[model samples]
Target: MEFDAVLIEPRRAAMIAAGLWLDKTADDYFDACLAAHPDALALSAIHAATGARRDLSWAELDLLADRAALGLRALGVGRGDVVTCQLPNGWEFVASYLGCSRIGAVFNPVMPIFREHELGFMLKHGESKVFLVPKTFRGFDHEAMAEGLKPGLPALRQIVVAGGAGANSFDALLSNPAFDSQRATITRDTRLGPDDVCQLIYTSGTTGEPKGVMHTANTMYANLAPFAERLHMGGEDVILMFSPMAHQTGFMYGLLLPLMLKARFVLMDSWDKALAARIIEGDGVTWTMASTPFLIDLSGAVEDLGTDPASLRIFLCAGTVIPGPVVERAQRVLGARVISAWGMTENGAVTTVLPEDPAQRAAETDGVPLPGIELQIRDREGRPVSGPGIEGGLFVRGCSNFGGYLKRPQWNNVDADGWFDTGDIARMDAAGYIRICGRSKDIIIRGAENIPVVEVEAALFKHPAVQSVAIVGYPDDRLGERACAFVVPKPGQTLSFEAMQAHLKAHNFATQYWPERLELREALPATASGKVQKFALRQLLRDEMGL
Candidate 1:
């Protein structure tokens, strides 16, 4: 079965020759890990809402994974099929992903926060065959929504509810005796090669469309070793993952990284700071990766509890700059090496501070590129930015980088020199550490989540009272950014913030995507060509807030 993805031959050949793209999949490492440490802990799952814990050994998880694969097959899922799973951080999510990888099915993980507006587009575009979600999560009926949308999606063949009664129940399917009987015939397929695209993740692009970022096993594996080696991670180290497994940050380092290292990981279904702080000390969690707000909250919780989370050694935070005070306090309180980093859905954690670097380095820069990757800054003309400390568009090309966007090979956007435009503005110092200055993508990195500014604006265009609308982000101390909509009302008509929100709710947008504040304007500042001048609007908010 052929998977849908773009694989440039020369690049793949070069990476393979250099041994960077190890012709191995997560299944290979998982088997090796089981052989080496059959009795060792593989997952420590804690439900954030319930404070419930479940621990599984590597051997047990492997068994469940096999069962899950059989269950998926029974539902007509096969090689190269797109299976979309919308689950929080839990054992079920882990099992589903592993099952997909084992059977050469492309796992498309949807963030739980997405509602019909965002999710409908993705489900339709990917032509997903099987969708997995909890019966209910965070007070939302995910199963009900999936069932409602199924009629509209002809390719969506099955819906597997994680916690519900029925023939399609996820738990019941995994525990079926018939699948266990077929275990004897379950041979690892040699044809299920590392180069096959195993993952499809959607990231919002500048055009207000979600781009499906595809990754092969080799591309992802290339990122793990160099990153782990530089941080001195090993089988002995303990990991805690609080971020959603849907994001590449959490997906790669949280799930697959632990499997490759053959180490144990704790899954936090929600980001509960108090519980996380307690888990660190109780579980001896040594390594974690999250965004700025998490580090801030965790440090605060540690201080409040007056507990020394000495087991935590590395805390890698990305998506925004870490304030100097936050970094210092987190180190002083938690005793973890704070690492500032930057990455995209197209590539996972391309830049990160070294373990040996001083705390001051994290505050000053996002850090240098990882192994098998190269970073360059270029101008509008595509010429390399001449000197260090000069701000320009950042470009990245690496073995870990993703293939062309799903179904749109022309959107690969790589230049003749093989550099993919990162859409971030940055400046590299003489020391090779880069500081992110701005984004050309017109994006708002609110906390770790990328708020699709243009998409939100387009949604508001449905509002009858809205004559013109533009969404711009204002600085927030904790979340890094918060969207505020500036609008011009239709003549002789008025609009209110409540009305605007009601309109978005009708459109089925997630509450997180709604603009927090509304500002009325007589007219918007635009160019001669009538394109909205977003930078000027951002400056307007900055000046009004005295930032």
Candidate 2:
């Protein structure tokens, strides 16, 4: 796909001026901090299982990253190498990612839940030279998974495990005297341009194999500036990060943004609402970001424990839709605004509600496009759509837009004119505010009328009994496709399709939009990032409906 056709000329020019220049690479971001604040606390990693905490200063983090880079280089890792990382959220993951960037290697973050099926495909397709994983996390043996995949993945040259056996433990490499000496020789080189690939983020393949989205160092930086500006983050702010650093939201908003602003970040190995609240109340965390579910969990915990939400100033939601009620409760209970942002792995954070915006506006819309971002709604024929209240496929172009996918350079998703197709259906108001309706693939068509699944799902979520819900299209001989809902009721609550239909009907939803069939389950299948696995739910429906 070529992107030139959709590129908004003014937005492209602004992005060029604001985003980091190609001459300044990823390593330069870290180096600036080490030079300015050598003794300030840079990172604090808390082990969720063990209740252990490790702190690293600006100088210490730089040293550790350099040593890790040197150790990988000694094992023949160099420029353009793809390094697959499967460790949980912790200091090891942060250091290793920076180390790879320092040596011009592409960082590939894989979710820990991915086993042989997903892991094998990424390893082979990415042509990974080195893999950094934990020995064991939450009873899953990562070492065994790597060994199981070794036979099929011949390009894997080294397996560096963080905690388990049969591989080089990360601690030993950092402590090795030989590697320590090599760190002094490592220097930041400008040869690695901003356009060069810095990370290969694999999209959660709901359709088939995951595609490797190649993002550059400048793209990463471009994604962070608007977030920092909107939240009013500065060097004095302390951030608490519980999201995985390998994912785009975590890598950009949680980790890289803090580094860019020279702010202190507290990292947790896993998500625990109680622990996260304590970090906010006890550690003086001023800013944080996570999915909507996490915010719900945190709010519930706060209500149960009666904890005061005084320290937290900004609570941002990404990767998923933000429920209106959740946003209202967060503002009332936590005294922090719940801002929802939209983006994909291909582009970092693109659109977000500003912190100062009215709560009702933030809840109703996805907010305006961030500075340097050009957003457009286009018809199927690729003509730009004008006016308000009309939905079309969203096209985006800016400095933050990625060059292309990794390895499969020919598989471009951008148009020839430089506009990247977002695959999401959206509408632009006369004021230029963008509101996402749903994914084009996710839209349910009934008798030639498009039913916004997101709108239906959002309405269903407002029910007190509904814990989680997913709306998917089920094939129909008459209508082409009809809406089917899979619902997980809250514990001790009983719900049925009839009850949900009545509730939605009261809200003015068209009767035809009501789900024809509903499946009630104990839990909904979800990706590591907490998105509903609709494809899995579709298969479940097929078995039940006998389609």
Candidate 3:
């Protein structure tokens, strides 16, 4: 947990000298914005199920954060503590994150869809001090689930629910009048700083265990400023973010940068294209940052409804390379330019096309790296690779680089020179633009949500009938990829796809992590050294399924 090991003094001083690390924290900026324009609209939260909306001005939002901070302090929480929040997009999420910042607690936002199978390990691994959740979201009682998990998590001190009754209530903490005296005391002394770890987001790992990505405010701000400047965003632009607040895509660009820009941002609980169209038309939304599916869905909805998206300007797509036809359709129908981007949980937006990049350019490449970031392709021997036709592993190192993985220091993967292997095979053109060809890592990114292939394989291995298993990704037009599981049954045992689903469900595996297609083999194709040849399986999918 000693961040000094990752962010040494020399790199910190260098980044600061290069103007990449702004010494000021988000807490500092939020306080300044509150003082400068207390009544300016800061947040708009929409309820997807009930079609209700809530808007909060600067003063209201800041005061709620202040109260939440004091209430957290009232509990055993203190500086450097971890506060895990697993809530959908709403004011509660915003307040919880800001509250953590105000009191110098590290915010760990988890995906709302994660069930007990995933949450049990994450809560324990994070050493979570205080846990926050909604009483019931999408008809699942998160509070009840957390209560079920409490006994196993010795570090967890409290579970506060948003719509719960009794003493453990999030809204009660926000509305507590007793904490009003310190409404303006965010500037008070605290053991936190811009360089201190502020966010701990978990990302899928190739080794079957989720890695906690640690980041400081300065490290995060380094990417946000350059990305916003490249896209030409400002206060006048309104953003609608339907991606879950937990994902880094929404966490950094959705919540953090919007507060820094002092812009009006709308947070949707779910991805309802109809509701998205309504909000776009009603609120004059000008931009958004999501994955390819969102752009396709929004454009299709806008075209179907005949809504005039004159105010909409940029649709930033990440995680997948969008097709040229999709980009042209979005441009023609939605009246917006698609800005292709690429990033990871280890870092925020690293590469993105410019605001004026044409559809062909956007589709052909993932664009150049953002300022203060460097991307290079190297061969298997770790030497720099050259030219357009040759493919090599992509490595990135820059000011926007993350500190390190939380507990697994060996998993950090940064060389002494600060270069981190991105596990991607890419080709670079003469224009210094890199197009991702393939990934060396075993991860399936289905619709921007990463499914850890090794983790799923590990879980499926527990099945009695499963003698061997390998998870592979097959191309999907809309989601970019879908998972297919290849299994070898035990002697005299026969397995059906339905049986596999039943076993996974009984084991409490996440529904999203389950394989859509299942294939049974007498034995998997392996190397002489007994390593499964996943490329053969992927190729089999390409040839057999005509994917």
Candidate 4:
């Protein structure tokens, strides 16, 4: 479906006027590689658990994509249809994405860790026509879960399975008899364009259900172009990506960016610092993009396991704040440049520290906004604030900025002037660098995925034993933060952590959203308006944790 002109015309005119919107699509680059240098290594992977490795050259990958595209065509998936893939980091995801792009279908990636609750909403909301899942991943029966969800998903016509028993096997699809004819059909009149939607990545906000962030080919290109240029990435570089492929960081840098640069990309489906260190040392890895936890674990692995990652050069850390001392320690221990970055699924890599940025800048600030993007701070009343150190709401507008959330006009999260409210409180220095101080929204970012605080609290409030509940983030040295629930039980009632977790499970909430720690409180701090003061709760926890 075409985007509403009201959302497209202004952003399009601005981006085109600035020459930031490249008219090229991702398929265009891969198609060029097929003709010029098909033998080049484009993607490599080491299983996060099994330690098995798989490598795919550009020619092999492109051919597999053609067959997958044919398989999709046979299933009636065409332009504008959504293909949701919940596979781990592997060649299957790469093939699915390429095939979808080849046929003008939108590729939607679901995190492997997400269960029935998350998948049910995303697939139904996205109107996914074809859903792909690994039969089993990390010991969970994803195939069974997908089958159970099929009855509720009216638009889902096919469920393709990878590496396990299912109605359709991914391996057999690669050898489908219709592949050649379908390839010809796709090449005849490919309707995909730069402004066409490429992906619909869902991310949680202050709300309960996650919002699908839409990105067109041009928007993604705008981000990948600046990232590659700034990092000076090329075919010679080997990227070790431990972030989930479903997340934007891994989706862009780990999956698409390497293909764009004709470089080697290594991925780990699960995060294991010891395994990651081994990959870095064995594969001659040069750079990676992940969150703070990965940095901490890798640093520890280097020191404790005596792993030599001397070939690693740059580590782009995002998802959460990196403690200043941790950044200093990472540089000294890993012998790599620790670069800080801040971005969301709505726009990939909006602001990031440059390769040559000072260590202090990387630690103290989130870095400057990339070219073609504009960042500003405003007060609660929406008036622009001109200052160096004053904290205000952060807003951004750029070529890479997303158009709107899927099927939610009221939740567009943007103003009439085309600025997106980042929901972050930040300060901009005189030199134009931004430092995020806190969040203006009620959400906790646990290991890069946002936990909808209100949703969880609302569910917990339904419990018979609970009187009042507030959820807040507690500092953690590894994960950066974890959810801690403070509950005031009803008189003559007691709530245990096990019972609370059981309640959440019964409510069909993802385990990741469940509070890790439970604290019993006699009363919670409140305001004159009878609303819970979460800041007080957070501060109390901070003091208790001595953070």
Candidate 5:
């Protein structure tokens, strides 16, 4: 189907020029909102432990961000400087991000759980001049970790602690009386444009060292516009943000989208299914985004609490595939549409289920491309794949697509025609419904037949006893490489290889698809974002099986 040749027509020069003039830059999105609705509630951060809510009006948020930006300027931070932040989902994170954006500095938000090994790499790669971190969160001593790694990170010039003693407090930095004066003097000349780099988001590093993805303001803004339009979000909508703002989904959909639409944002420090449900029911949260695991946890808790789950209108699942039954259950029980999205850190949010899609269609596919986005499935030789149900590598081109990795120019995956290779395998139906097969690198070669691990994992998830499952290729002398299943059984359940095999057999999965070996664990190792750490599981299998 030569999808690119047919589907991706070059934009008219006049329309391109019009878009360039009308597009909102990161600073413009914030500044215009503050000017238009100064008293509107822009942010609400609730501390789950104490149930204390911190609300910020648009004026208040602007003042704080401006002050923080002035403070950063005083510290020699300027345009193009990278400021890395490691804080929980809170008002401080928002302030730091906006403060950086206000002055054209690139914001680099690292996950709070990242230790020195991961932190150092991001710091060096982004050439971050300053770091903002929480001192302690749930017993993780970030201060100690930062202090331990400070000597090795030569590019890191300053450290500001959001909380804790013996460090420069965030409040102190913004307390300067001259901050307001500096903000008053701030001009549009210092504002970041749509094309200017706004952030450097690092990949999850499932296969190798994490790459720092560079995104411009236009890339992120375009990613949110379609979602905002499809979801019908407006100033009255209240978005509850539980995901880390470091990742693309949280930054684009949860944060930037709200700001652009002039909606209220509720930020949660951590994810507690019960607390999340309460926020939705009590505060009238309209939208939220989380992984499938989080949705399962919240649905179970809502059932246990005997509370109706109709408060939230939009529930989005990203970062992984959504099982069919999970979507069905969510729709039946919660009255909220389960929107399965397909995107990566490089391209904020690309495809999402449209509201008009049939329930069965939504369950089977990842929906069509967002407006102004183009998708193509190509073979290994870079030729387009034709016909329905044919799986191949997915390539995408759109305004939302990021330019390239920061510093590491060699990792550019885009072709000469500007289409970025997504490293994911997917198939498109005649109706344009896309189904992700698996990651190109994650495909398991069993003898000569290619086994899509995602298909097997999805089939296993249907088992009542299986809470989570990861399929990895284990080295085997006899079969070259064999599929091994790492299963996390539901609480109070025990699953053996024989039992799992029987379950798969009953589910009508191919006999060869049954895992050759099974490893039972109380809990699956997961990233902070709830993605299964398949590489870690593979290592554990290698050690246990003595491969």
Candidate 6:
């Protein structure tokens, strides 16, 4: 794929001039960091369930990465081959990613929760040659699972396990001294450029099957450089990351940024808010980037446990519409600036609230684009909307944007002007800040009227018993489609349809906007990134109604 066709020369030059686009790949920068501070702490991993802790210095991590790279090369995992890793957030994941980069192999990190079906599609689509997995993680035998599917995967040559007895042990790669002699040859053969594909992240299958989003080192760094600068982060800052390394939010900001800034990263493979509070106070964690659920849960935990979060500074929230009350309460309790952000697997963090921005903007809007990124909103007729507060199809163009999806060359869904439709209905304020309403496909059209899902969700979020809420559409004979509310109630609380209707009515919500049906659930179906799967809810409703 020629990135020049999508990203023109002038903008790329401007980005480089503005210091947003570094000319170096991530591996080159990692080597520089190793040379500068070999003894500095590079990563700290915490087992979320057992509370076991491990720390690695830059020197130690570099050695492990070198050995891992050599082991991969010995297994025929050469340049341009996809090295798929399905491991939790730990030192092994870090080693795998850096090792792939070292040998010019594409790092494809699959979520641990993904089973054979999802895993099969991703490995096949990525054409992964060498696959890595934990021997057993979260009670699932990953080694056995991978071995079960190995016969069907002709492209997969090896299955490397992270722990326990397995076909190949990841620890052996670290202890193997034979690779020391092959360093020169390995360096000579592992040549890679800034434009070479470094990461292949699959989108969360919210609406459908995931797409293999391909990103180069330059493209990933374009977002990370400006993000670190905007947050005023430095090596002194310690980052606590709970989002899985497979997700882009965690992959780019959580894993990649630490290497760039030479900062310390604290990884948690699971989400436990109480443990998070303890880690924050004990380790002096200053920053984190995750979805709204983490922010919401952590705020509650801090208040309940009376944890001292004075060391925590910034929280970047994404993946959903954050209710205003949740943001206000979270800031008051967590003692951190709740920064709202919006991005997808196709692009890294494109829009984010700055630390200096007003608090109201953080609660009300999703913030403006970073340098090298541009957004435009268009109507149904492909005409650009002129004024503020008018909702339209959102399109974006930027250097941080992806070049194309893997193996889907014909699916380059971009306009002639190079703007990619975000598949979102959004409105831009006069000051250029964007507020995402919802996905264009998720909107419920009831009798020629569009039900604003964000507004309804926000309003319902204020209800006392409502813990989480999602509004999905159901087929209706008269209205073509009607709104259905899926509610997860607070603990020890139960809600009824009559009570919900009265609550919305008392709050002055219109009848047309009110959900016609209410269904109580323990939890809403969500992607690993915390995005609600409305299509799954719609499917359930259809199945129940026999539509």
Question: lDDT for each of the candidates?
Answer: 0.87, 0.76, 0.86, 0.85, 0.76, 0.81
- Counting only residues 3 or more apart in sequence or on different chains, how many pairs clash (N, Cα, C under 3 Å) in candidate 5? 0
Candidate 5: C-alpha lDDT: 0.76
Question: Which one is best on TM-score?
Answer: 1
- What residue runs in model 6 are displaced by over 4 Å at the alpha carbon? 1-19, 173-181, 204-208, 441-547
Model 5, residue 156: distance off in Å is 1.2
In order of appearance, the predictions have TM-scores of 0.98, 0.79, 0.97, 0.96, 0.79, 0.80
Task: For candidate 4, write residues 66-118 as lDDT tens digits.
Answer: 89888887889999999999998888888889888888899899888787877
Q: Where does candidate 6 clash, by residue pair?
A: none
Candidate 3 segments whose C-alpha is farther than 4 A from its true place: 1-5, 182-186
For candidate 5, write residues 210-252 as lDDT tens digits: 6777777666777787768876778788899887786666778
lDDT of 2 by residue, 1-547 (tens): 1212122233445556654333456577777888999998899999887778999999888878887888888778888888899988887888888888878787889877666656788888888988888898888788877877888888898888887443387876633456776665677671255667777877642333467877766676776776578778898888888877777777877778888888899999888888788778877899888767678788888888888779888887765556677788888889988887777777877888887788876667777787777898988887888678789999998767876765565555676667888888999888777788767656665533445576678789999999989989877643546788888999999788789888887765647668988888898899999998888887888888898
Task: Go through the candidates in order and give the C-alpha RMSD of each one to the true structure.
Answer: 1.3, 10.8, 1.4, 1.8, 11.2, 10.8
Q: Give the Å error, residue 61, model 5.
A: 0.6
Q: Which consecutive 10 residues in model 6 have the weakest lDDT in total?
A: 1-10
Tens digits of per-residue lDDT, candidate 3, 1-547, equal: 2443375354898998999989877887787778878999889999999899999999999888888888888887888889999989999899888888878888999998888888898989989989999999888889998999999999999999998877898866645778899766665576368888999889997987898889988889999988889888888889889999899988888898887787889999988988898899899999898989888999889888887788888888998879989999988988888888888888888888888766788898888999999887899899987566579998999988888888888888888888888888888888888788889988999998999898789888988999999999998878888999999999999789998888888766778888999999999999999999999999998999875
For model 1 the local lDDT of residue 531 reads 90
- The better candidate by TM-score, 1 or 2, is 1
**lDDT tens digits by residue: candidate 6, 1-547:** 2222233343566667777678778787788789899998889999999999899999988877888888888888878898899989998899888878888888898878766656777787778898889888888798998988888888998988888553388876533677777766657347567777788877642334457788887888888888888889988889989888987877888888888888889999888999999999999999998766678788989999999999999988876656788788888998889898888778888898889998778879999998778999999999999899999999998878886776664565676777888788899999999998766655575542445576677778888999999999886533546899999999999889998988877664547678999989999999999999888998998999898
When summed lDDT is taken over every stretch of 10 residues in candidate 1, the lowest stretch is 1-10
What C-alpha lDDT does candidate 3 achieve relative to the native structure? 0.86
lDDT of 1 by residue, 420-528 (tens): 9889899999988999999888788888899887888888887888899998888887888898999999998888999999998988888888889999999999999
Per lDDT, the best of the predicted structures is 1
Question: How many residue pairs clash (N, CA or C atoms closer than 3 angstroms) in each of the candidate models, in the order given?
Answer: 0, 18, 0, 0, 0, 0
